[model samples]
Target: MDGDFWHGNPKCYRVPKSNVEYWTKKIEGNRARDKKHTKTLKRLGWHVIRIWESALRDEEAVATKIRAAMMRHINGETT
Candidate 1:
């Protein structure tokens, strides 16, 4: 599960008033590293599912997303 804040959730992400630059860089670095890791995982033939921390609050939505991913996998779609 990815932390919404760290991964820069478009819905609820905000840079802190204090240490704004630091937080921005940190989150950006995290996003970059996450992208890299996701690429590596997919290259190694892993089905990647990124469910945000906040998204987990809505169980039905999460389930639907997972089910969609599963269907895509069963249909031999990889990304």
Candidate 2:
């Protein structure tokens, strides 16, 4: 699970006002690292599922999405 801010979710992430530059760089770095890691995992033949922290509020919805992703993966769908 990824925290919205830490993962730099564009939907709802803002750099802290106290240290704008630092936080911006930090979050940007985190996002870059996340992308790199995900790419590596995919290159190694792993299905990557990233669920945001906020989305965890709805367990049923998350489960359905996961199931759908799993089904797509099983069906050799590149998603």
Candidate 3:
């Protein structure tokens, strides 16, 4: 599911949501939090592959990308 920033805000400009939320501004350490969350999920045996909000623009390519992630997850290749 897409977020508010991706859906309308022009500032986002082809950036991933993670990049947008965590990497934007020097407000705080959102990036580090994201890293922690990802690591936590991975440690819990969850395959967590993230796609950029812009990547969804191409439906076919997005499908392929998601499928690849799923394949990797199924194959037990830790993300």
Candidate 4:
């Protein structure tokens, strides 16, 4: 996910006081949708590797993870 707020990051997201219910529902829906999509993709034989927004803060770690996933896929190890 690109955004901490929309993706429901516990350490970063806080519902706005002005419209608590609306924000809560919106963020929750986003999380549900993300989960559903990831599950669907995996079921369809996709290697779904989710890199959180916070992980992007460390460029080297993100690159390493991507490389590892690619290597795994190349080795026919989807799991």
Per-candidate clash tally = 0, 0, 0, 0
Put the candidates in lDDT order, highest first. 1, 2, 4, 3
- What Cα-based lDDT does every candidate model obtain? 0.93, 0.92, 0.62, 0.87
Q: For model 4, how does the per-residue alpha-carbon lDDT over 9-52 read when each residue is reduced to its tens digit?
A: 87788888888899999999999999999999999999988877
The alpha-carbon lDDT assigned to residue 51 of candidate 4 equals 74
lDDT of 3 by residue, 1-79 (tens): 3342433334464455576665455223444555688899888877776665666788899899789988987787655
Highest lDDT model number: 1
Pick the winner on lDDT between candidates 2 and 4: 2
Off by over 4 Å in 1: none
TM-score of 2: 0.93
lDDT (10s digit) by residue, model 2, range 1-79: 8999899888889788898899989999999999999999999999999999889899999999899999999899986
What is the Å distance of residue 59 in model 4 from its true position?
Answer: 0.7
**Cα lDDT of model 2 overall?**
0.92
TM-score to native of every candidate shown: 0.92, 0.93, 0.60, 0.85
Model 4 stretches astray by more than 4 angstroms: none
